[model samples]
Target: MKNSRSKPFVIGISGGSGSGKSTIINEIVERLGPEKIAVLHHDAYYRHRPELSFEERTIINFDHPDSLETKLLMKHLVQLISGEKVEVPIYDFPQHLRNSKTKKISPCQILIVDGILVLNDSQLCELMD
Candidate 1:
C-alpha cells in the first residue's frame, strides 16, 4: 500500500563514477512504469561559460560541483514542484559548459535524479525538507 497522492517522490540516486546509478534509475522506471516516473540527469545542469573562451572551458575539471549550474538546477526543481514544465540545460563535459539548446522536462508522479554527485549540496538537501 503506497501513498498514491504524493506528487513525484523525488529520489536522488548518486554514486562514484562508473557506478550503477543509471541502472537503478531504469529499474525504478521499469517497476513503477514509465507513466509514473521521469528521470533527470545531473549532467544536464553543468555550469555555463558564455564568457569563457573555448580553450578555458575545455581545460577545467568538470567533476567538481563548481562545474555545475546548481543554482539554476535548484530553481527548476522548485518550479517543477508547482507542476510546471521546465527547460533543463544541456551540458557538454568535455567543453565544460551548458549547450546552446535545452531539454524540456514535464512533471511526473515520480522524479528520480541520477548522477555521481547528486544530493551533495546542502541547499539541495534542505530543499527536500
Candidate 2:
C-alpha cells in the first residue's frame, strides 16, 4: 500500500451511497484537526474500464459493487499499507469515472476510508482480515 509503508494506523468506513459518511468524516476531521488525520474516498480506487465509456458506466447499476474499479483501488490500498505517498485519482460522479489529475496524499497518523461498496470485494475483505 502506498500510504501504509510507514505502518500508519488505518481506519475503514463503509455504507450505502449517500450515507453521510462524508458528514462523519468532516466531523472527525474537525475533532482531529487537519494535522492529526487523513481521509480517503473509495471512489478514487475505481479501475479505469477504458472499454466502457462514461455513458455505459453510468447506465450500469452503480449501486452494485460490480460497477467499481476494484483493481485500481487495491493498488492504492497496497500503497497506503506500504507507507508511501500517492496521487489519488479524483472520480467524477457526474461523469461516472475518474479524471486525469489525481490528488496527492501522504499517510498521517490515521487514515480513514469512506465509501459504499469498498468492503464488498473479496480482495479488500481479505485485506481487512
Per-residue lDDT of model 1, residues 1-129, tens digit only:
264765557778889877888888887777878877767787888777879998887887778888777788778777776788899888776666767898888887777776777789878665552
In candidate 1, which residue ranges exceed 4 Å CA deviation?
1-3
lDDT tens digits, residue span 1-129, model 2: 133444656667789867888888898888877775767787776655668876787777766676676767667767876778788888777776678888988867677777888677777655542
TM-score quality measure for candidate 2: 0.79
RMSD per candidate (Å) reads 2.1, 4.1
Question: How big is the positional error of residue 34 in model 2, measured in Å on the Cα after superposition?
Answer: 1.5
lDDT of candidate 1 at residue 55, scale 0 to 100: 88
lDDT of 2 at 97: 66
Residue 121 error, candidate 2, Å:
2.9
Model 1 TM:
0.86
Please, what's the RMSD in Å of model 2?
Answer: 4.1
